[model samples]
Target: MKIAFTAPMKPLDDPVPSGDRTMGRLIVQALELGGHEVRVASRFRTWVKEGGDAAILTRETEGLSEADRITREWEAEGYRPDVFLTYHLYHKAPDWIGPALADRFNLPYAIIEASRAPKRQTGPWALGFRAADDALARADVVGALHHADAECLGAVLQRDRLKILLPFLDTLPFETAADLVIKHHKAPKLLAAGMMREGDKTRSYEVLADALSRCMDLDWSLTVIGDGPNRAYVESLFPPERTSFLGALPPEQMPQHYAAHDLFVWPAIREAFGFVFLEAQASGLGVVAGSTFGVPDIVQDGKTGLLAPEGDAEAFAAHLRALIPDPARIEQLGEEAARHIRFRHTLEMGCARLNAFLETALDNRWQRSTAPRRPHQSSGQPL
Candidate 1:
């Protein structure tokens, strides 16, 4: 099958390092692994951070123009795709070209990680919300990455059209690092990784600092990774002597860091199933994160890691205090964490799930096109 892929939130080859970009690359890899010819259809991003209806209109016009150009080129070359797959459709970054191209080519349309926010229907993002809603209605199949997204997507799509596509990655590097690295820390070494920015990220840092402050009596050292505009403020939240900042590092250098540490800690306020949690667990590190949104989907409480109530610094601190004294329990959790990721979350598993989704979409499209049509009573036309 030839699949035309698009990521409206971020381009697959974007130089900036982010979770969105990483997921986009992984989707392409998964499709290729399934023996499908995948091509990135467009790089025209439709994300609008802060804008009125005018901003949405401008993007809509540009998106239509881009779709026209691609249609012409593909027709000239006689290249027709069997399916149109899009990743990350939301009010902030609704897909504008995928639906148009899919209609023009008469192909099955599918979306991954499609979120619907009914509250945005009347706000400043009304146009974008409507556009996203229309796209969701037209999708033959929608893949939800976590349980929370699946619930919200169910409100607008049929139950059979919605599938749970668990978050996954290539865990070979982390698994190799876990097998090779031996931790020998004087005090239990803790690790946390996230971009330091305003909004929810800085709030997570604040909660982490407060939680760590309450556990000062315990002997532990924390290493923080990532850098952003709020680095200075985020650094100020933690004690200089107890925390070591590694700044921002490349993706290739992260597995060793995860393996060197004994635990991964983060407040995870409003996080959307963090990839860092998966990476940390893949490297045999037990996690302690706030139970919010999709955090529970990846990290099983009491099985792979401990989850505190969201934003409760006291509960988070108590969990840390309990684990710091018991190295045996920490090791046990880490072992379980590694095993969980190996069995349930991997590139191969993700590829199989994606292939199944494509097959379902194609079958749905074929049934709809071949179904019997009734004539309209008023105009004598096929309805």
Candidate 2:
């Protein structure tokens, strides 16, 4: 099967290292691993940083033009995609190309990680909201990475159309590193990795700094890996002596860092299924993360890692205090964490799941198209 894929939020090849970009790349990799030919249909991003009616209209117009160009190019090359798939669709980054291309090519349309925000329909992002909703309604299948998203998506889509595609990663490197690295740290080394930006990331950092501060008497050292515009603010939040900043490190170098740490601590405020949690657990590091959206789906509380209530520094601190004293418990959790990722969240598992999802989407499209249509009671139009 040939798949025409696009990530409207962030292009897969975007230089910025983020969880969104990582997930986009992994999805393409998963498709290719299933023996399907996947082509990135476009890199024309439709994301509006600060919402405005004009911005949304401009993106919509540009997106339509790009869609037309792609259709013509594909026709000339005799390449017709069997499926048009998109990842990460929301009001802020609604997909404009996928729906147009799918309709033009008469292909099965599917979306992964799509969020529906009804409240945005009357705001500055009204156009984007409507566009995203239309795309969702037209999709043959919608993959929900988080259960919370599934609830809202279910309102606009059939229950069967919404499939649970949990967050996953290529855990081989982290797992291998976990097996090879020997822990020799003097104090329990806690690691946190996230871009030091404002909003949720910075809030998480602030929560983390406060939580760690409470455990001052405990034997632990903190290392943070990431850099952003608000680095100074994030740095000031943590103690200079206890916390060491590694700045931003490439993805290739993360496995070793994960392996070096005993615990992965992050106040994942409103995090949508953190990839770092998966990587940390895969590297045999017990996680202490805030129990936010989709965090529980990956990090099994009291099993692979411990979760504190979202934004509660006291609860997060308590978890840290408990784990710091007991290296045995941390090691046990780490072992289970590694196994949890291997059994359920590896690339191979994701590939198989994605292949099934695509097949289901194609089947659903065929069924819907062939089903008999009912006449509308008011106007006698096909329903």
Q: What are the per-residue Cα lDDT tens digits for candidate 1 across 251-360?
A: 99999999999999998998778888999999998899999878899999998899999999999998999999888889999999999999999999999999899888
lDDT for each residue of candidate 2 in 1-383, tens digit (9 for 90 to 100)? 77889999999989999999999999888888889888999998989898889999999999999999998998899787778899999998888799998887767799999988789988899999999998998899999998989988988999879999997899888978877889987789999999988899999999999999899998899999999999999999888898999999999999999998899999899888898999999899889999998899999999999999999999999999999999999999999999999899999999999989988887777677753742221221222
> In order, what lDDT does every prediction score?
0.88, 0.89
Displacement of residue 369 (Cα, Å) in model 2 is 1.0
The estimated TM-scores of all candidates read 0.95, 0.96
What is the clash count of model 1? 0
TM-score of 2: 0.96
Q: Which ten residues in a row have the lowest lDDT in candidate 2?
A: 374-383
Give the residue spans of candidate 2 off by over 4 A. Answer: 371-383
Residue pairs in candidate 2 whose N, alpha carbon or C atoms collide under 3 angstroms:
none
